[model samples]
Target: MTDTGQAEQAGGLSVVTTATDGIRVLTLAGEIDHHTGDQLRHALEVTGTARPRIVIDMLRVTFMDSSGINILVNAHQTVTEADGWLRLAAPTDSVLRVLQLVGIDDVIQCRPTLREALAL
Candidate 1:
């Protein structure tokens, strides 16, 4: 596993990136609102990889708004178009509720643990 270090921080959000095998794991902490949406989007952007497999660990995310939802939806679409997949891991109750309410959980896979998200 290789740590990509801290990828971005804006407002109350912090994103740390790491890679194992070919999958990129983004561990996020703090709130994800309009102010932090760009940071999250940037962290999700695929660079060299053709089919970027990504897992977003949201265990520490305390809050999220429509902006965050939009970012996630856009990122999911982008990756899916590239034949990649994006998964959400261990989101808190509040975040999971939001995802479920918005039907994001239906669109993007949400795993109960990081290990599950990382699994094929």
Candidate 2:
């Protein structure tokens, strides 16, 4: 089994993975901002090397700002360029609104759940 890279931190945030079939489900919790964006990017970079479809579970993300959105855009671009996929799962209403206002919703795929993302 390929070791899936998962990030878990005490205070800042955490990302947990649950894989079934070939899809990788990454669940995020806590804040996503300038302070934690780089760390999140690094974790994704590592996982990206494996070329797995990425479903980012954001149901627990309590806060997210432009920096977080930038990180998501970067990841989406990177994965697409690599012929992989990146999808957002269960974004908070606030995050969803921000994404809509910023027009990122048109570019990145956002779904209600990881399973839904993978099916698409």
- Per-prediction TM-score to the true structure, in the order listed: 0.96, 0.84
lDDT tens per residue, model 2, 2-107: 3366556745878777665676677789888888787677667734266657788888988888988898888888888878888888889988898899998899
- Most TM-score-accurate candidate: 1
Off by over 4 Å in 2: 1-5, 46-51
Q: Kindly give the stretch of ten consecutive residues in candidate 2 with the minimal lDDT sum.
A: 1-10
Model 1 accuracy (lDDT, Cα):
0.93
Worst 10 residues of 1 by lDDT: 1-10
Could you tell me the TM-score of candidate 1? 0.96
Global lDDT scores for all candidate models: 0.93, 0.78
In the range 1-120, model 1's lDDT, one tens digit per residue, is 899776777789989999978899999999999888888988888877898899999999999999999999999999999999999999999999999999999999999999999999
